[model samples]
Target: MSTDHGDRPVTGVRLQKVLAGAGVASRRVIEQYIVEGRIRVNGAVVTELGTRIDPEHDLVDVDGTAVQLDAGKRYVMLNKPTGVVSSMKDERGRPDLRRFTREWPERLYNVGRLDADTSGLLLLTNDGDLAHVLAHPSFGVTKVYIAKVDGRVSPQTIAALTRGITLEDGPIAADKARLRDSSHGSSLVELTLHSGRNRIVRRMMAAVGHPVTELVRRQFGPLRLGTLPSGHARELGKIELGALLTLARRDSPAEATPGEAREKTRDHGQHDDQENG
Candidate 1:
């Protein structure tokens, strides 16, 4: 048993059992990780196999990556189709996220937005702390987009995207850009960036004289939009959820403890920059 700050009794399961139950690994493997000091509760590494934790409250990390101990939390990936809005409800009567999310019992909200005209991977979740961290551009969760542009994109154009260009908002650069293919007066280009600026990819391509004709976000952080048909949504697999949690933990500042992170998320529920191209 563990006690809260007020000294109230709180029942907790053993650390190894919790990790094993979350599918991090088998109990024996978790024990090995605990023995090797590769696990942390809250922010401190715990090597004792007998340690117990309040699963609903305490944060756990394995090999420095956060683990989602709260099984009730839902992590969903929706390959949003063009013309559907990102909002759960659209007063304007436009098609919205509710179409895809209504099936879940928990009220899941999108971690970020994609322009109605754009389509790709969008994370919908009930985990507010993870959503806040992933949606905030300052945390540097990279997004990759494959774009079909109006003009043939050259190596110089790719170079320029990475070298940085001055958008109306400010100067920005793709962490990486490459021309995937070029033919018949149009080109396929892939760009990776961490920016959450509105219609950023379209603007960036237009800036380089190759306006985007079509765009699809192929990846968001560690999650990939792979073979899920357009407009379809699916619950994240355990491995996928693990990767997302790990990325969120990695991007969050070291000093921000789990309790502080949750409190901050609740205090500023609307703080995440949900908008993106």
Candidate 2:
């Protein structure tokens, strides 16, 4: 089977084969999905087993969940260590992502910036569209962080975080904030926010009179840092990739009108600040 590309006939891989290769399901199960009209290719229901798709260009989904068919695409989670910059390369002779990215053959880039002094759960990918959805200010992807800060944090301080506080740039607030521990002249705070502001967490803590001494991002969207050790990098598992793709699809540029997206930004607050991982 093939698809027409302009005046040329472009040969494509069988739909089931592509899905199976992506570990979506066994070939037999995929065939059943096709027969039941549970699969879609580029928004059109595909019930034909002979349907061939250009995996590179066609969007495939089953039961509204996106299926990534591009084998060349790589999704990596790196537990970046402090002092390493988020950039692929640094012009000022500083440590950068090359140490970890050199292991992959593809020219991967970090999805968003993580402060050189902060660390954890940085995503590196060659998929530009996925990066855009996850990293773009308009998407407001949720992030979770744990911070160790000066002084004891009380329930009031945690409450203040969610209540919103003024920053040098503007007003910001955490979606959720909690005191993990408060003792030994220091406190541990867990903050959840969709803001991508630079050093937002540290600033938020400082606003409550608890300046952060150490910070680490634990989650971004559906991806978690898990037990991955510091300075280590790993490829996302099949399930993880599927969840990430689903998230990307949900916030995809095509899914919202410009006005709607702008409204979402306003409702979620201005997350235009670059993420301080």
> How does candidate 1 fare on TM-score?
0.87
Q: Per-candidate TM vs. native?
A: 0.87, 0.87
lDDT of 2 by residue, 1-277 (tens): 3544566655789998899998889999999999999998988898877788988778888987788888888889999999997777677889988899788999787877788889999888877667756666677888899999999888888888999999999999899999888888998899999987788898888877989899999998889999999999999987788788888876776644435443443222113237564
- lDDT tens readout by residue for model 1, 41-153: 88888877668898887888887777888888898999999998888777789998888977899977887788888899998888777776666557768999999999788
Clash pairs (backbone) in predicted model 1: none
* Residue pairs in collision within model 2: 196-273, 197-273
Candidate 1 off by > 4 Å: 1-11, 25-29, 253-274
For each of the candidates, the C-alpha root-mean-square deviation to the true structure, in angstroms, is 3.9, 5.9
By lDDT, the best candidate is 1
lDDT of each: 0.83, 0.82
TM-score for predicted model 2 compared with the true structure: 0.87
